[model samples]
Target: MIVDSHCHLNYGSMTEDMDGVMQRAREAGVGTMLAINARLSEYDEVLAIANAHDNVWCTVGSHPHEAEKEPGITAEQLIELAKPEKVVGIGESGLDYFYEHAPRDLQKANFLAHIAASRETGLPLVVHARDADEDTAVIMKEEMDRGAYPAVIHCFTASRALAEACLDMGCYISISGIVTFKSATDLQETVKIIPRDRLLIETDAPYLAPVPKRGKPNEPSYVKYTAEFLSHLLDWDYDDLARTTTDNFFTLFSKTRRP
Candidate 1:
């Protein structure tokens, strides 16, 4: 069975037809899903979705895009909110220089708070890194020196140097459908060298649907396409790729139970 390690089930299209979405995911061999919370304000909706589905789990924390909204959000607040059994990870948070929706300083401060919560709670930090690899790497390394915390770089599309740096720090790299694009040759090559045990796959659904599903609204079930592409790219059996990524998901998000 496959696991869509990151998705936004609370968003419009999927939320309106959650039952249908869950059914489709099951039919697609998706055994479990991690419903990511991109904003603290939406935690209830995200958590409710997870609470309603036994195979679904959620995370707590703001995205870099929403950093300015919650710049003062502290690790203590995140730790308190994450006490819920359904909340399995922290922060789809990190630097997103590509969009720059939030100020860089605010984003960094917010990212560090999420890191602290992850360290304290021992939950994997679901990181969203884009075009800020240097600062992201430096912050991660600095924090790792303070105390070790589990993390996964979700939807990674940075340089090979960043991938290698993250891997060196024992962090897992999650590839999205972006790796299947023709223009992503660099990312594709980087993905090939990622250790199997440290590799993961996500749809980041409602966004980045893989080829064939490209340009359409993405969903958790579409993660299979990303997995299928990787099986070919990495030259592993399809089932084996599914199993490896699913195992890696549970390993990093240890708070979630295998369904």
Candidate 2:
């Protein structure tokens, strides 16, 4: 069985026909999913998506883009909010310089709060690092010095240096549907270097649909396409790849049940 390590089920597009979406995922052999909460105000909705389904779990934190608006949020607040049994992770956080939607300082502050939450609770941090690789790597390294915490660089398309930085810190790396694209040559090449045990796969659904299904609204089922391609790309059998990633997922997010 495979796991879609990250997704956004509470998002409107995917929620409109949630049952059908999940049905497709099961048919595609996806056994579990982690619904991501990018905004603190949306915690209940995101967690509800997980609570309502046996195969789903969730994270509690804010995205970098929303950082400025939530600058006052604290690690204590996040730690308390993450008290639920199914809240298996502490973020969708980190720096996003490409968009610059949120001020860098605010994003850094919010990221530290989530990192503190992860360090405190021992839950994995679901990070979203983009063009800010230097700072991302720097901050991650600095944070590790403060205290190590489990984390994964989700939807990774960053430089190899950043990838190495994450792995060096014992953090996992999650590849998304973006890897299936013809233009993601750099990412596909970067995928080759990720240690088998440190790798995870996700769809980041209703956003990045893999090829053959590219241009269509993404869903959990589409993760198989990315995984299938990755298996071939890495010269490993599909089952072996699935087992490795699934094992990595539960190991990283230890709070999840092995269904």
Candidate 3:
């Protein structure tokens, strides 16, 4: 059973014709997904999608991009929202220096709040890191020193140093469709050494579609290509690769029940 460990199902393209999108995923053998929410204001809609679909689960928190606008976000608030059984993770939250969508200090504050929620709730932190690998790794390490919490560097496209830092902290790394790009050979190389237990795959759909599907909108179904590509890169059988990642997802997001 394959799982799309992270995606934005509420994104326009995905929500517009969600049934067909989900049907395609079923047809493609993608059995479950974690529909990530990047803003607290959109929690109801995001949670609605999960409520409407048995195999879908969700998280609640603010993205760095929304950090500046969501000044009231608190670890206690996140813990309260996470009381629902379906709310299995604390964030699609973390730093994003590439866009600087939110002020860096505010982003850091938001990221730390989510980390606190993760530590308090025992739910994994669904991290979304971009060009700020150095600072992101520093914050994650410092927080771990304060107290340990589970986290996954979702849609990872950072440097090898960042990857090693995550692995050393016992955090998981989720590879996305970007690894399929010809220019992403370095990322592919980094993906090579990730221990099987520490590795997972995602499409980051309605966004970065893999090759062949490049330039087209992505969906959970598109995770098939990423998984197939990783199987080739890691020399694992397709079924075994899927099973390994499925187990990894279940292990890390233990709050999510396996179908």
Give the per-residue lDDT digits (tens) of candidate 3, residues 19-47: 99999999999999999988899999989
Worst 10 residues of 1 by lDDT: 10-19
What is every candidate's alpha-carbon RMSD to the true fold? 0.7, 0.7, 0.8
> In angstroms, how far off is 257's CA in candidate 1?
0.8
**Residue-level lDDT tens digits of model 1 in 128-223:** 898998999999999999999999999999989999989998999999999888889999899988999999999999999899899999999999
Question: Judged by lDDT against the true structure, how good is candidate 1?
Answer: 0.93
* Over 4 Å off, model 2: none
Alpha-carbon local distance difference test for all models: 0.93, 0.93, 0.93
Q: What is the TM-score of each candidate against the true structure?
A: 0.99, 0.99, 0.98
The clash count of every prediction, one per candidate, is 0, 0, 0
- What TM-score, to 2 decimals, does candidate 1 have? 0.99
Q: Write down the TM-score for model 2.
A: 0.99
